[model samples]
Target: MMASVNEYYQQMEKTGIPKRFTHVLPPNEIEYKNWLVGQNGLPPVEEWRDRMYAETVKLLKTMQDGCKDQWDDDYWTAVIESKGVESPTNGHSLFSRCS
Candidate 1:
């Protein structure tokens, strides 16, 4: 079963990955999120949430796989922060942009 969003958030916190890291999610993830949003109500909403959690977990794992030895908190932190957050020009919530 896929983990809950809270579980994923907790895992990210434990690993020193900030929630802000979502701001820098790769293009595929962004596309997935957009597609998921477009399919709203076609399936149960919980299913959407679960799929998103799975995708995010997959991305994180791929990132960790690229590390030389262990997960490098500093490197990930710098990469995430360097991407920074863009303001929502259309007045949508900042969180919605990540969604």
Candidate 2:
């Protein structure tokens, strides 16, 4: 687990060893307007749909692979779907369904 790794790294640091993670992607946000229909909210946009999906999937699978032992399938799915993707339609969020 990451926490255990971090702990080990911390102990090593006391003796002057560096600790590192192989894969760490910074975070970004995706707007949900496109997923929603033209109601009271903003109109949908086409550009974001494919890109958002691709990016979301890539980030998710990468994280899942990296943290395979740290998280169960359901937990990893929850982390990605909740934080990364957006669904403006259906009056719900992609992360919600992922959970």
Candidate 3:
């Protein structure tokens, strides 16, 4: 029997290819950028932006994990408003308090 879509995605995740290529640019584009850097000895502007975004996401995840106890709606709402970003959860709580 053929695998379901979820199973296909799970198999892909197991290979770790998706994680390795999480950048918005295609693999060919990234390769070309690397070649350009090799020629000029300077990184592409988009490379720096991608690195900054990845670092910011890592930092935010660490902060969220560290403050799991404070993962209430009020905290998320305040954070979303402070960043001038819309709430991804549509104003709903993203996590439930652990007993």
Candidate 4:
């Protein structure tokens, strides 16, 4: 299902994150921006706003591809907002986290 701007903002707030940036930009637009260029060593367009929303969708789909029930949409949203991809090195994320 296609997500909405409000859904993205809600996801961000659920993680105790400020929704100011994403409140301005939607999720698909935010992801497209990240896929484009960078700004000051950070995501150029709207900063880390709605990143949780986009990443949560990505993570859930990733898990659904193989792991399936290992994570539902809710679980993915939490993890995406929590620690992200959990790389062995940085132990955080591959793409979407601000800090």
Q: Point to the candidate with the largest lDDT.
A: 3
Kindly list the per-residue Cα lDDT of model 2 for residues 1-99, writing each as its tens digit.
989877767866786644553122222223434434555576655454545565556667778434333223354345445756543434433353331
Q: Show where candidate 3 strays beyond 4 Å.
A: 1-70, 96-99
Worst 10 residues of 3 by lDDT: 19-28
The local distance difference test score of model 4 is 0.53
Please write out the lDDT profile of model 3 over residues 1-99, one tens digit for every residue: 346655755765886757445444543555766787879988664444455445445556778545444434675456556666666677556664456
TM-score of each: 0.24, 0.24, 0.26, 0.22
Q: Which stretches of candidate 4 lie over 4 Å from their true place?
A: 1-3, 23-99
Clashes of 1: 0
> Ranking under TM-score, best-scoring first?
3, 2, 1, 4
* TM-score result, candidate 1: 0.24
The true-versus-predicted C-alpha distance at residue 89 of model 1, in Å, is 26
| Candidate 1 ranges beyond 4 A from true positions | 1-31, 38-69, 85-99
User: In terms of TM-score, how similar is model 4 to the real structure?
Assistant: 0.22
Give candidate 4's error at residue 95 in angstroms: 24
TM-score: which candidate is best? Answer: 3
Q: Write the per-residue lDDT of candidate 1 for residues 1-99, one digit (tens) a residue.
A: 246777867877997888988545554554666678678845333443455466556655877435333333344444444556332234332122221
Give the higher-TM-score candidate: 3 or 4: 3
- How many residue pairs of model 2 clash at the backbone? 2
Per-residue lDDT of 92 in model 4: 35
Which TM-score value belongs to model 3?
Answer: 0.26
